[model samples]
Target: MKRNYMYIVLAYGLFLGWLLSFPYNGPVLKHLVLIHQVPIASFSLVYTVVPAVFLIIYLLFFQIKEEYAKNIMNWSITACIVGTVILFTLPTYYWYPVLAVMGIGSVMYIIGWSYYYTMEIPIDEKMRIMALVIIIGNSIYYVINILHDQISIGFLLAVIIVPLIGAFRATSNIAVNNKIAVELEHEPLPVKLIFVICSFLFAVNITDGLTFHAIYPSFDQLFVEYFTFYGIMPYIITLVIIFFFGTKLSIMFPVFLGTSVLGLAYLSFGLMGKNWYSYFITETFLQMGWALLDLVLWTLFGLIASIYGRPLKICGYAFLANLLAVFAGGLLAVRILNKLDNYFIISAAFAIGIIFISFLIVPWLSEAIEKDLRNKLFKTNLQNKPIEEISPLSIPLPQREILTPREREIAELLIQGFTNKQIADLLHISENTIKTHTRKIYSKLDVANKRELLQLSFSSRMSKGRSS
Candidate 1:
């Protein structure tokens, strides 16, 4: 549509505007670290606190599904403006709180912007656009910082351009009035999936946070250069790699690959100390891998939103899980970073152990969840009927007599081994609605789960045969 094209233009303009307005994070961090003598641990406040605030906002306002997108955007803009003002003034009194608020605003804006694109744009196109945005943003930011020692020029441009970017119309994809009227509890987020995602995130982020805190401040200029180059080089290269190899593969393929790179980066830092190449590897490859993993994680959460029928809720939970782990990891790093004697060796060993656990837990957890769901479904069926023997002819008897026509249709699919998700898709309804109907079908048939319903159908057919 013309609307989508307009949005694509706006997205590009927004990134350009953002970069022009706020050059690079390097200068801000440098100002805080050098001028204010702010502890590296203090910077963790932003990552830790902002998502919690957003989570609260998500719970309070977004739950109603009324003007969700607009509200999020407004909050983000306000926060960013406030953050920038405080930073520009270079206030000494309330340093942490001011920076934290700014971080909140900026991060919220980013979250809202990302959510909009994911909802509105197709995946392949979205990936390319995002890559371009990063490449351009970082290139502009670093170029400006490298060219001029004074930050005044960037600030002046930002003052002129940010408002123009703000005035552009942003499209909202969330329906103002939700038709299904499903309650929050019916969202059907699997526990095992949450565990797997949260655990993996925690492991990766903890390693990064600890190593970053350990090594970053020691070589500040090198750290900034490394990330600047990382942003320019790897962003493009990874996108190209993914464009070719990533098309046919599962998102998890990149995730696993990223995890490997991340672990290696950690190991290199642990063993190699503060060498320039180590910095390059850590900043470029490790970050590239992180970006890949991050892309998939957000995309998966978007899929979860579609699957569950509560976009805001599912996204919020995913965000909360990710941010919570990141915050905890940062805090832990702050504590142990100073305490460890041979920090590199211990950290490398820790990362390896965690990665090993990740491999064991993720797949096993997935299988365990599937097996558990099946077992729960099978409990009501005391008699074992061969699954295939439950036939079309058997459909008219017992539970079929009790179920509504639509429920019967769903029951037939269940007997045919269609998953709830598959049934939802085929029926062109939300998965939550499918689950609601499934529960109703179970209740009507005096059955606990899918296996029992099929058994009743089969048993009814056997009884009919005996009577005949």
Candidate 2:
């Protein structure tokens, strides 16, 4: 970890130098879009294809046979790079017919790949549903890009491409690579609690890129459109930094998660669905927050190394917390957006408040999510034999799955001694609003009153060995 930190500090210093070296009006290294004269095939060979080859080579050379996960990692990056290219290369000068296939193929591949992300959830029939959704969403954006690429390639990428790829990397990487700790130490919760921080970094980085486009639409439209591929660089840097430097979950996780929630809440609810432009603007804020959030994550690492600890997990929570948060947030954001004619007013007010509350309280439900995971298939035969009705790996989250992102937050708040009024205040809604959200929290926690809620919270974590 220390080594990784050194790389980041050096990289950061060099990056700062480059930023300062540029003529303000001429070209900022951070924002400079690299253009290559090579053909798509040739450039992809160097960028996408070769990197894939390298990973294959590395894995083979090292005799690493974890094909499912490693392949997903390598190819997912390729999909994003190629997809970003196809998404951006329109109407400028380098539009290609193959881009259509590349775009579509990459989408399918990523969707297919995400299945292998976690040993807990491998590819199955369900993945088809996920793939179809991707196709539908991409088709809509594809049409939008065709219509407006000339005006602003960046906007489409920011709103569409970035999120999709971000989601892609998230689901796949976390599922496969991250560690699933059987329990937490209670004191300085490590991997489990680290999730909040990862989400913060992820949300902020994504939001940071989006912010540029929101404020400066034209430039962002082109530069960011192309740069979305490179946007992965910070995360890449983050991983490298983590690998060499060492980070602590207790320190980094909380701060990153807090920043991410606030920023993402601003993106989704801040504008309150005022318009497509609102989304554009809010997303821009989220993108900037992501980088700063990452810095916090790195700092968390610094603190950890100051002592002596290692992140027990990697892509698992680092990726999933962000994924699930976005999943839940997007679900809420869309519902509110569609249901409320005053979309902006309703969406912004509700999302921000809940987001804040969630930041304050999700660790409480760490138990429930884990409890459900542990006993999911456990049962005792009449005679006296233990049997698991289902493998935690195979059984999908039920239609009535436990703890949603919102409910989890509500649980946290409940434990924190947040009354309905306080929650309402934090969420920018009414007391009645708090009642409604609290009700959901109760259902998820399977308890009545604040007492049961707190009881369930502790019990759930204790089951998972997370006691703090």
Candidate 3:
């Protein structure tokens, strides 16, 4: 607990420094203050794009097999180092190190969340105290500016102090706040920690990128932004907002966050900034649209996760639901975005290609956001929901009759109300075996006669046909 607190403090301090640089405030801003100088955008290379790639790598590799502690830690540290170096280097990326430290805190928060919920361990007070110290220390930088005449930095520092404090406290003490979570047990800490940092990095990058851009149009990389999942991220993030809290009520969180992000993007593109309007518009649209869709889907994730007796079933349904929605949404988007960008006919092909590829990702965003929304909406309470659009009565797993594959096929046919001779004809099996198998099936199903056992089977088959 105390250890984490220390991390929080450092995160806060880092945030303070980054925030001060947001307005490009230095010792001489008073003579010539430029609000449009969003120095933070330069960090996008290190914070947003680079981390995005690393995360993809982490997920892909981590999912393949169990990642050992040594490997996970090595990669995690490597990622942090490379990210830090890039941030510390080029003028455009200098903001990296400044924000990266605080990004670490965000990662810690995720670790805390996962540990507290999934692993179910008691809070470590020591880590909490350390985090508290870091949080306070980070704020001290701001406090210094306030007392020392702004050093020309007073205003900028003040703007950052609050968020820094929150980040510190949340990141450091977060894990210590909770005492029990089983899910943490199986989770690879290194991999989870990497993504946690990523979440924060994305948050800061998105915030800084959009904020600075609003002040003044800058950068040529926006073509990539628009062509990427830029518009859809807000919706993707909506899932986390909802999931953080959990449940139906939590669903509102994504909407709230999505709305705010959209509003900010709108202000940046519509009223304040120019240059990257197309990309911003697309990103804003995806963000808001994902939120709307999340409200619908996350509720379902909650129901599916909780009510389905089988975990695999939960995954299966989730996969199918999102598959259908994404397929529908993707095909629909290709047709629409092409028409929407009709004015730019020369670049229409490029835009259309990007649109098609990006659409596939919507399923993930929609599914994720749905989970977040569900988590948030019902944070305070569990709500019964539509697990399935039509909740069909489920038959328990068929009795393990110890039948061979071919025998099971025969059984399935018989269960469909086929006569023994008909079942034999379908499977090219002899009638004598069909009869013998029927007797065996009835015996296994514990029916004194064929009538009772096959009665349930026939009823189930007929019902399935009717539903179909």
Candidate 4:
């Protein structure tokens, strides 16, 4: 709650702005290939290798820092600029690899910024913010694509430029973690959940890979049509569900159910059905299912990072896992594309198995996570209580300048690193009210972040004691 919600909104808005600024090739790749006389293989090579490079670099060297989010946002903007220049100016296929590498960089920034922003928010706001960002960001993406041919090159450039300027301001205002607040032990992993999640992701990724490649060859014309008609459908439905029924249901329910639908949809698509109506039905389910899965999966990843207090480690691993799953799926799909009967049979069985397993896995994982979080809280409370003979009550107070009683109370709790939600619970106030109090405290004290406030308060107290 120490964070301003407006900042969160702005940060996310900038991310979307940066994302949509990159020219979408899905609708134009064929034209670019045929008209520009560029080899299709170059594009294929780029699409294949970019993810590999991204995963390798991330695993080898990406580390979390205080300015991690801001830095990533900057990198994304840089990459977008580079990619835009190359795509518009260069017609040669030779530059495809270079553009691909830049694209990879932009994608990594997307993931990195998402991790950084989501971890700071309270769990209560995580789902809503995640949904809102996706819905809005993707809407911009689709709208840009829909107008791709109709708009002028200069106008497109302006679209890229305007949001970016605002994004820069928003990103700069974001807080950085100059120090590591918590150290996490990586041993004693949650074996069951990890196993299930990995297996499920692998299976789903394979189906997704197969479906896309298989469908695109026969239905290339439908890409833009599908995007036009149903691009925002899933996101809208997701927003409604989250807005209307978020409190009544656990996220695990939608996650499992959506995944199950996705599996079935993939199975249908793999069977080589020629009926246009069936394709429409399959795609409709695919969009909705994927929307829910994306929302829940990324939110879960961010939550894990927050809970473990190791944002980079958790998110990096998740990204790596996704990369591997997608890569393997693509390879398998390529191998089986000629054998439609076998592909259909195998994909259908995999889908059915995943759906059944999901029922058992999702509920168990949710319960385990809740139980573990409770245990951690209990242990933390015990550790916070001083065990020495001296009581906390005997300690001298910080000699700060005049503060409202409410502000003083908030400062003390903030010093203890209690989240906004925790403070709201303790004070029986709304989290929004807590945020307002925090903003006022920071303004009065001229501090930007919690660490600064704590330092200022303690230093003043120490100076007063020395003089006395």
Q: Give me the candidate number with maximum lDDT.
A: 4
Q: Mind giving the per-residue lDDT tens digits that candidate 1 earns over 1-468?
A: 445544643543454445333422344445445556656444556535765776767656755342355576566665655655665566555556766665555544545554455455544454444444444444444464453345564564454345435433442322222232232123465655755665666666665556556656545665665554444466446755664555466545666677677678678877778778777766665667666766566555544443334555555666566666666665666677657778677767776786677667656644654464454345323123443443432354573666787888888877766677766766778899889999998888888988888787789879988989
* Candidate topping TM-score: 4
Query: What order do you get sorting by lDDT, best first?
Result: 4, 1, 2, 3
- Report the Cα lDDT for residue 156, model 3: 40
| Candidate 3 Cα errors over 4 Å, as ranges | 1-41, 60-152, 170-180, 183-468
**lDDT against the true structure, each candidate:** 0.57, 0.39, 0.38, 0.63
lDDT of candidate 1 at residue 333, scale 0 to 100: 66
Instruction: For candidate 4, write residues 1-468 as lDDT tens digits.
Output: 345455666666655744543432343344346557766545654654576677677667866563365677677666655665566567575466656766576556656665555445666667766776677666666665676566666675566555556655666676644332332323455546555665656655555555656654545464546656665576567665775665566768778878878776767766755456657767777777777777777677666555555555556556656656656666666666545655556666767776777777788778866776675665466446543421212222354446787788888777765678777767879999999999988888888999888788678779878999
lDDT pick, better of 1 and 2? 1
Who is ahead in TM-score, 2 or 4?
Answer: 4
Q: How many clashes (backbone atoms < 3 Å, residues ≥3 apart in a chain or on different chains) does model 4 have?
A: 1
lDDT of 2 by residue, 84-124 (tens): 45535544234333333343334233323322322322112
**Candidate 4: global Cα-lDDT?**
0.63
Better candidate by TM-score, 3 or 4:
4
Reference-based lDDT, residue 438, model 4: 92
RMSD of 4: 13.9
The regions of model 4 sitting more than 4 angstroms off are 1-3, 9-25, 28-35, 39-41, 44-48, 60-62, 160-166, 176-199, 216-227, 267-272, 338-346, 379-468
Of 1 and 4, the candidate ranking higher by lDDT: 4
